[model samples]
Target: MSSNAEIKISGFPEDDGYWFVKWIDEFRLPHLTTSSASVKVVLQKLGSVDFHNLNNLGSTDIRSILGQRKKDADVIIEIRCPVVMPGTLPLVFIGAIYQRGVYVGRLPTRRRTIALADGGQEGFELSLSQQITPPPGWPEGAPYSLLNRFEYSVIPNIMRSSRCLMINRGEDTFIIPRMTIFKTFYAPHTELAKAFCGGPWNDRLDEVICLDDFESGLKTQKITHPEQWNIILQVRVPDVFAPLLACFTLMSSQDRALL
Candidate 1:
């Protein structure tokens, strides 16, 4: 994280509430070394609201935040990100919604990846419409009230490659497998579980199935306390993704809500 590399957000709703948001990022030197790279920026919702009155609350909040008393909106999520790498690869903005530690639905952004270079700075904008449809696999006719939190990750496709398995059984003879073995890149839930149920708890859990069992325990009445089952979302950029320089400076903004 170079001092020159920073992320900032402005135009947040305050005096005149507006749902629109502008995010700016400045990446220099080490952050822009690679010709192309895949980096994910995650946006996690922290507040917990009552689901029973979700409709009224959502409408009221929208009107209040957007400074439009007459206009009504179901939901609004507009944000921008710096596009360090731009090509044919589309920007994948996915939202994973959860309710009490249970995976419920996913929301995919509507906008495509666009290159906007201003004085050596590059970025793109993401806008979700008011008539957003429920993600596939969501229960038909189910209300959005079931959702408690949102974890959205913006993944820009830059390093695209294909892998092939070549097996040699005889001299000068090789066989290529037609099928490609797919592996899960990353599991956010499992990572959360690991962080929450670490140390002595791991020993007590069964070996055959751990993550499923942990989720089941949380879903069932095994965890009596509601606070115990809370899922905390953390956004971390591993060293593999953003290699840091020894003396580079890093800038970050603290969330006032957390304070």
Candidate 2:
């Protein structure tokens, strides 16, 4: 078996202000990590956003940010500055995501709730109430296979400047700690005890970058390089939200010239 399960994601130009995201996963291999047998999923072509247009339009038009719209695209990411202070003119940035013809959620500097685009508030609560199964085809008897899907909820910390986002399953909860060293901001590994060994703190995942060029606005690759756009995810985990987290990270990275 291969050492990693790779997923390819591509999209429009980063200079256009919006990205058209799509991902493909065959689940052909299993990546053995400290916590579980995970897969490496890479999200490439995280297109850039032109802040120039936002000034002219007076509002961030996400749908036209890519210049041309692909109605079938999986997800769309848009960056906007909703608030500004005397010295912090346009410093605060928020990312808005749209998928399946509806608004998915917003990623802000402070903690906030995420509502599914298609599902209303009731559907959002329902997903958290039940235990979600992982994608099929893992060795059925392994202990890690029993890991439940986590529902990420943002809890506001009234006393602190930034709120806390919690990932919970059953009675266990893991708080997503923030790291500013990446310049892009990233959430270090907190899946299990073993995952803490080599992460952003130790510089294992910080240096990684996407190397492939996106002249075509979209393309697919069979292999992934550590220097290029790639992601490592726990096997059979919540596949839907992984990319969302990745995009949120990229929105702050120096690679996109943001925050």
Candidate 3:
């Protein structure tokens, strides 16, 4: 992706937290491209208190393989704060935003050994820093160095009980909040497919953007109601943090079905 590449991801929600995630080429000209693949994954949850391994609800055959998971694996995204889905335990499947194996951001992990090797314990942490090397195919002049310095965290809306990602760069932090409009706008009904991007509260509602019924042309609307209305999840963040934002958004898209 070019440094100036505008990243706009808009998708229909399968239900509450699960989204029929799709990568849009541009917000103005929202459309899916051949290079882009449809990813169907559930954004598990970031329980109000702790972290868990963000799990994939269905098949693990995620379409886009940025790189191999074996020795040939180019990127390994480790969920610094390991959390697992309710049922799956011990053996955790923590992977998100991987497109054909490319978008995998290596999570910090300890070097394991066949035999017991006593050493510093790998604390549960996901730090975006110099430790994260750029994937092999990254553009030469892109912000490869700056990418490492980015510290990502989840900003929880305790009152609303929803959570969004906050990627910090010095004093500046970009927020990626997913709003499930189906519940907020049409609480009693569940037939509308909507994707809204806005502030954390009602007073800040003026700061909204969207890829839903209100958007122009409505050319990009693919996943319709009955079939996909309930599962729509809209992840809107600044263009600069799109790549990293995808990592977490795909993991935990919304705090709750409503917020």
Predicted model with the maximum TM-score: 2
Tens digits of lDDT, candidate 1, 173-230:
2211111111112111233223222323235222112233254444211234553222
Judging by lDDT, tell me the better candidate of 2 and 3.
Answer: 2
Q: What is the TM-score of each candidate against the true structure?
A: 0.19, 0.20, 0.17
Tens digits of lDDT, candidate 2, 79-123: 221111111111111243322212233322234454434332122
Please report, as a residue range, the 10-residue window in candidate 1 with the lowest summed lDDT. 175-184
Q: What does candidate 3 score in Cα RMSD to the true structure?
A: 20.3
Model 1 vs. true fold: TM: 0.19
For candidate 3, lDDT tens digit of each residue in 136-216?
787776654212212221111111233233344445433333222122332111111111212133333222223255344
Assess each prediction's global lDDT (C-alpha) against the native.
0.26, 0.28, 0.25
**Strongest candidate by lDDT:** 2
Native-to-model Cα distance after best TM-score fit, residue 111 in candidate 1, in Å: 4.3
Provide the global lDDT of candidate 1 against the true structure: 0.26
How far is 161's C-alpha from truth in model 2 (Å)?
Answer: 37
